[model samples]
Target: MTFLRDLLGIPGASSDPAALAAAARDRSGADPDGLPLAVVRAEDIDGVRETLRLAHAHHVPVVPRGAGTGLAGGALAGTGAVVLDVSAMDRIVEIDPVDELAVVEPGVLTATLDAAAAEHGLRYAPDPASAAISTIGGNIATNAGGMRCVKYGVTREAVLGLDVVLADGTLVSTGRRTVKGVSGLDLTALFVGSEGTLGVIVGASLRLRALPERTLTAAAGYDDVASAARACGDLARARRDPAMLELLDGLTLDVIDRAQGTDHGRRSRALVIAQADGPAADAEIAAIAEVLGKEASWVEQGVDAASSDALLAARRLALPSIERFGKALIEDICVPRSRLADAFAAVEEIAAEHRVAIYSFAHAGDGNLHPIIGYSGEARPAGVQRAADAIFRLALDLGGTVTGEHGVGLLKRDWLAREVGPDVLGLHASVKAALDPRGILNPGKAL
Candidate 1:
């Protein structure tokens, strides 16, 4: 504690009990292993470097945190660790419309950057549901994906370069501002999704896109989630590339209806919401509606902007709506688009077999599903653990991943080996060893 205070002499340093307790945990709902030694609210790159230097010399573990909105416990601090809170370093350095790029500090909010880009007739493309609150550093750390991922890809795609502070407090810059660069081993991509294990992210150069000329939204009602998933597959088969596509299951719809006082469940057992942007948005949405109409019980297309936002709000409310029931164990699994219906069927089967209620929603265009299991207890039930394991195995069986965008934090660490095999797992350890030989950076998380 004394060491941390001395290292960061800035006013941002704190050892308050309340602040330490709050800094120890993230949104994952998992209890921290123990309280952190201290919380250092870094306001600039020098503060981060100094903190890391002290921690490295003392062999104290350091946890790099952004907005603390991670769902995978990646930011949770453990015993004897130093929590380096970087959210105070929020600054947008530059926005170059001509080059379609933006240079920003890691602590800048995702939505704030997009809003700034919009001022220049451009926009940042990667938008997670928590874009309004989550920091860019956190998104880049997890390589986050959202509904727009179906078209624009994930955070890794938008990042052009990074300024990282290694475990030994060495500052190194990777990548270039130009669109094309193969100057080296693409270390920027490696650090983007490293979950703060290899190094601490201080700054980033991000790619931006021009705002769409036109946009359209469409919604379809189906008798079941399987039907809606099949419709998504049909859209893919027909080569209809929507900017955003989301799906909600019957149980999820019921929860949302109860919370929002809407009759979505009464209207249909499942719902599919989609959006198309750019010059061909109208034609793309028309084709999407035609394909979904084939199996949908009802179809609504070309909705007004306000109505479209209202419809999209339902999808965003899925997680919080279910959380009201109890402690929700949110699971992120993705399968091949062709096997989406099969995956949903397997989820239903698992829920029934385990005698647990599982509400699900999805980024259907990309085949990433969120299966939420709720429980009312101080500790997670054994059945819930079994059900989660079954879901991960099911994803592997269908040629998918245990996690699509959420990185493997403590919750998914054990299953990572099952997904990547022994050889690749060894390679991951080697990389971690090379980057952080002392193993003091965010230990016991990610790999």
Candidate 2:
């Protein structure tokens, strides 16, 4: 324990319940009780290595944390262990415009990288909802997807390489900058969505794409949630590659409108915001508008750069806006594209059956739905748990995943086996045993 103090001073190891409570929860706001004994802030790669070694020796569970904006509670600290806060490691190691790549430390914010790339007329495309605050390490660990995932893919696609420190303080680089390489078994990809189970990411070399020359955004407001699902399905079927396609139901709109004090409550709207970049954007927008018109009340087109950007920003604010109503148990589930409508229908039915308020929104193009349930008053632990289980089970019943972009942190740990059967869960356990045999790296998560 003294060695631990040598690396991370014990003078103020942060045993304060208030500080620990804040570190206990994530954006999901689900059962934030298991607070860690100490919060260890690492300022450099050596510091992270030293901290991991001490934790390994002392058999202390280490939960790697980024910006603490994780919606899945993946960064939640474990009891009587250490919380590894990497936010202090913020740094941009390198930016090679000619190579279309940027090497950044784990703590660098996603939006910060995007802005740096913008200076060179290049952009990082994996823009998650919390890009402004979420760190690149969190994005890489979660393999987070965003509205543009319909066209650009998720964070895993943008990351070319990672500099990881293993459980026992062994440092290694997975993947490379070369455009193509098959020398290894793609260990880097393994670590991308591993949720910090295999190692602690110190830095990453990410791929960047040229910024779009022109952009057009259009919003199609549907009268109901099902119709909105139909519009999303149609676009996917027609092979329309809109950069961003999101849906917000009436309840979601009402919450956002009331929260933001806007006039967007005239209809039961399932709004779809799409972006068409490049020279072919005009024609693409036309086809998209025609398809959306089939199911929406109206397709409002905004070609002006400012107007389109503003609408996209507003759409991103949906979840945060919805949080104003009550405490949220945000459920992230993804079904197949064709099953999007069925998923929405099932979600609506479940909310009605349980008599709970659910506001839905999603990257509909990819079939990733977020059914955020509002719970106020006294925290009925059992009731809240039941509603979340029902929503996740519905997604699994429809041949969908229990989680889309969000990882199986503390919140969805119970439902993990439901989505991935016992056998697969066992396989995951075996891998976990091999990588972190002592189970010191973020134990009781994703297992």
Clashing pairs in 2: none
lDDT of 1 by residue, 265-293 (tens): 99999999999999888888898899989
Candidate 2 structure quality by residue, lDDT tens digits, 29-104 = 6564566777767778887887888888778888888888877778777577677777877898888888899999
Best by lDDT: 1
Off by over 4 Å in 2: 9-22, 31-35, 378-381
lDDT of 1 at 334: 91
Supply candidate 2's per-residue lDDT for 311: 70
**Winner by TM-score:** 1
Error of 1 at 347 (Å): 0.8
Q: Give lDDT for model 2.
A: 0.82
As for model 1, its CA RMSD to the true structure in angstroms is: 1.3
